[model samples]
Target: MELSEQVAIVTGGSRGIGRAVALRLARNGARVLVNYRRQVAEADKVVALIREFGGDAFAVAADVQDEYAVEAMAQACLERWGRIDLLVNNAGMSWDTPLFRMTDQHWHTVIETNLTSVFFCCRAVLGAMRARAYGRIVNVGSLAGLFGNVGQSNYAAAKAGLIGLTRSLARECALDGITVNVVAPAYIETDFVEPLPPLLRTWSIETNPMRRFGTAEEVAAAIAFFGSPAASYITGQVLAIDGGWVMP
Candidate 1:
């Protein structure tokens, strides 16, 4: 019950790491708003699971890249819970293409989805968080942002931008009792990595000291820590949940 009576908004909460984070927060006693752009059914399933466990949660549809949609989503949270205590910017999309083959659309789509959406969602909740003098903001990033992965230039750039945003926002909100941090996971065992080519997947596992891809639940545990009061003194930091990969 670390987050008892708190309200959390988790983007991309329909599946993968986002879904795990939403469930974990709810398990800690937070009323959760599971946000998804598509996969309405998946989002509802997450909600159902939380409710079945006697936790409070509901699904809200929002394209996080759209400023208006993000605003409406924030409004919905406030209307239902009276305040927003945590915001997890976990909604992201990946486009894997070599730098030479990357088009403007490819670059923009990844940047907008992974980076711009964080801007929209963070700004949307800042007012309420500042007013309350308490907030926890955790942005989900990736190892590519830290160690530069081949064919993931757009993704790396977007996640790198997110790290910068996290640090700057942490400084700006420090006086307001709001903490901002990032969780960067590498090769997590989610649908996001299921399509990796055989050789690439082999390389992913062999290169890591742990010799395995991390699980969505493991990444969620790190996120849950950042979102909890236990981490109030921590901010402007990046924690890598990569099973010994990207050791920087």
Candidate 2:
């Protein structure tokens, strides 16, 4: 767990689970590059907090859905840190809607933001990681992708695609000492869930086997484990932090 001097990037690190992962990695001694799309202020705030905690961190703005932007983000990190040891594809976008109600724009947006972004970022870093023969990649998926939540067809499809991406990348990178995995979190009490209607929120809470929502810190720990040296042998797998909501 001594990741001192390791350079890592956590996409969507402006808030919620992404922010928590960024902070947790920093605490574990990684120089963090926090990426955000539109939340410049919030992303900067996370960077400030990381610095306050005596960790090396900085904010980088990029729309993950854009290939050029993702490539530049990776380039910036490499230029500043020399190399990247860990990559957490935590940036995602989603809006609930039934299948018939999902517009072309809706479907494409969700798929591009959630699934395509992972591909772009991972591709941008894979060459460098392969050249060095060292890397760790963790994708942040959702239980909704596994259980097929209603009114979230777009989200489910995109997240399911991420799992597939994780597996394929793991297979390709394993021989190079790169391990890729996914962390699927359910009903975390973040701003994303905080605004849900009372009944929906209550249902999500009570449905958890633990009778409560998982915390961002809990999910962060799972992400960190996959990215750490301790998990060198674990790859092409999904770890669920769902309060036992979707036990295998």
Candidate 3:
């Protein structure tokens, strides 16, 4: 078990890529805290699945956008597990309005949910991690951040901010044995992409060298790697799980 006896906090762990990452980490022997904002049933299901598989897990509710809530969430985890070993900032939302039509509310919601949430969660756990001199922070980013996308200016900007955040934090924490990295996924087959216009979806698949959308599990694998000891020497990096959609 690569993560035996470790503790992990995965935001948005109720479903999709976040769910997959939580399950993977649990399978690797980490006691996981599945954090969700509203999907209590979904989060419980994930925890149950882990428990069924002989892995330790529990669900916690927190609006990652709220700094106080995030801080409390981290504190609760530390109280329950005695230490924090990994943190996955995967809670995010997307607003697809074109730049010209984007509203202040839309822009702010996306930025606060996707980008600012990372800042809050990272800060919440840094103290305990620094004290222990051990931590793994894997932020879930997006290909939109790497290559601009139509009607996704807000999402792209938020994700792009995450990349910058990861790099700077990695530099600050590297000597402390804490690694920070980003897993930028493109077109994963999740509810997040199910509402895409058919034409655009087709174009996305066609343009991708693999000619298909990647799976949530695939993206989770990358995230799990970054959250594991295997990635100890890796930091301040972005691993794109885009099925060749992003060469860089």
What TM-score goes with each of the models? 0.99, 0.98, 0.99
- The candidate with the higher lDDT, 1 or 3, is 1
**Model 1: colliding residue pairs:** none
Candidate structures ordered by TM-score, highest first = 1, 3, 2
How much lDDT does candidate 3 score? Answer: 0.94
lDDT per residue (tens digit) for residues 218-243 in model 1:
99899999999899899999999988
Relative to the unseen true structure, what is the C-alpha lDDT of residue 58 in candidate 2, on a scale of 0 to 100? Answer: 89
Report lDDT per candidate: 0.96, 0.92, 0.94
Instruction: Give lDDT: candidate 3, residue 131.
Output: 92
Cα misplacement distance, residue 132 of candidate 2 (Å) = 1.7
Q: lDDT of model 3 at residue 25?
A: 94
Predicted candidate 2: what Cα RMSD to the true structure? 1.0
Q: For candidate 3, lDDT tens digit of each residue in 1-33?
A: 999999999999999999999999999999999
The per-prediction CA RMSD against the true structure, in angstroms, equals 0.6, 1.0, 0.7
Model 3: residues >4 Å from true position, as ranges? none
Task: Give residue 51's error in model 2 in angstroms.
Answer: 1.2
